[model samples]
Each structure stands twice: as C-alpha cells, then as structure tokens.
Target: MDVLQIVAIGLMATVLIGVLKSQRPELAVLLSVAVGVILFLLVLGKIGSIVDIITDLATRAGISMVYLGTIMKIIGIAYIAEFGAQICRDAGEGAVATKIEFAAKILIMVLAVPIVVAVLQSLLKLLG
Candidate 1:
C-alpha cells in the first residue's frame, strides 16, 4: 500500500471537507466529489493492470478468454457499484445508494447466467 498517496488524498479530502463545511459550502461539496472521482480513476488503472495480468495467465493456462473476460466484468461491476454507493452515501443519499447496490447485484447475476450455463455444460461433458 502507498501510505503517502493515501495520506495525501486523506489530507486533501479533510481540508476540502472542512472548507466546505465552514465556507463556500457548494464548492466544498464539489471538491469532495471531485476528489472521490479522482481516487476512483486512479484505482481503476490498477484494476486494469490486474485484469491484464489475469488475461495473460489464463492464456498461458489454455483457459478460455471469454471466461476470464466474464470474471473481469464481474470485478468491474463490483468496483463500480461500490464506488457509486460510497459516493451516494457520502452525499447523504443512503436510500439511493442501497438501490444502486441492488441494481448492480441484479445486473451481475444476469451477466453471470451464461457463464454459469457454460460451466455446467463443460462439467457434464467431462463427467460423461
């Protein structure tokens, strides 16, 4: 973990939050949200690197790229859902955030259906 990066972001967020609460509330709110989004983007780059590594490993192991892709999609959905939910909560919209989480879960399940079916079929073939 990059402690310095985390500390820098934390300090920035804290200062902005304090500024927002005391004076220039509107700008403070915007600053907080902008900071959140910037952090998310930075983490997303790391996630992309992880996905690339997974794809490389899967290729080496002769696993289907489609399966790897599905897994990565699931990870992305989770990250996005969490990011959105946290932002909403931070913005004082807990109810909306919960709904967003629910929607994301449903979408993930729907997307996984085909992958599940494929896995089941592959298993049955192996057994037979």
Candidate 2:
C-alpha cells in the first residue's frame, strides 16, 4: 500500500488509456475499469485493518454499535460513490457521474438521520 507504487501504476495506466483511446475506445474504457478495480482490491486489506481498529476503539469507548455501523456505512457509501463517479467520468459520462454523486449524497443524508436524531434526543434530555 505504498502511495508511490499506486501513483506509478496509475500514471502508467493513464498513459496506456490515452494511447488506446483513439484506436480502440472500448478497450480504453475496459482498461480504465480494470485499473480502478485493481486499485480498489489493493486497498481492501488496508481498509479491513482500519475497520478493525475503529471497531475496537468503539467497543472500548462503550459506543453504540448502531452508531459505529452507521458511520461505517456512510464511509462505504462515500467510497463506492466516488469510485463509480470516477469511472463514469473516465468513460466521458460527466452527467452520469454527477447523478451518481447526487444519489450518493442523498443516501448518505438518509443514513445520517438516525445519528442526528440520537444526538438531538440526548441534547434534549440534558436540557430538560
């Protein structure tokens, strides 16, 4: 998970995609998708470790699992949305990318409502 290695690979892929785009646009799109998947796979192990750390910290802090789960879902949605949006953009579908981003934001807001409500309830209890 070296940043430099990932950057190098990305730069190489960009060059290859650029070279292929004129001659075989379909292949270029496939190559971009492949690179995105590969990059995501490379980071999955790191993501797992991060999740473990967060879970452990939450447990130690006596935080509600529901809150932790919601946070994780929100983070997952953000990453997935960004990934989809970037892929769409790479394929020259800016409108589709924007739509994906907009949908993701809406989903994130929906997921966050529970947490917000919980906080507001706690504040009301304290004030009362």
TM-score of each: 0.79, 0.89
Q: Which residue pairs clash in candidate 2?
A: none
lDDT string for model 2 (1-128, tens) is 48887898899999999999999988999999898888888788898888899999999999999999999999999989999998899889999999999999999999999999999999999999
Error of 1 at 26 (Å): 5.3
**Which candidate achieves the best lDDT against the true structure?**
2
Off by over 4 Å in 2: 1-5
For candidate 1, lDDT tens digit of each residue in 73-95?
A: 88789988998888678767899
Model 1 misplaced stretches (Cα beyond 4 Å): 1-3, 22-29, 43-48
Each prediction's total of clashing residue pairs, residues at least 3 apart in sequence or on different chains, is 0, 0
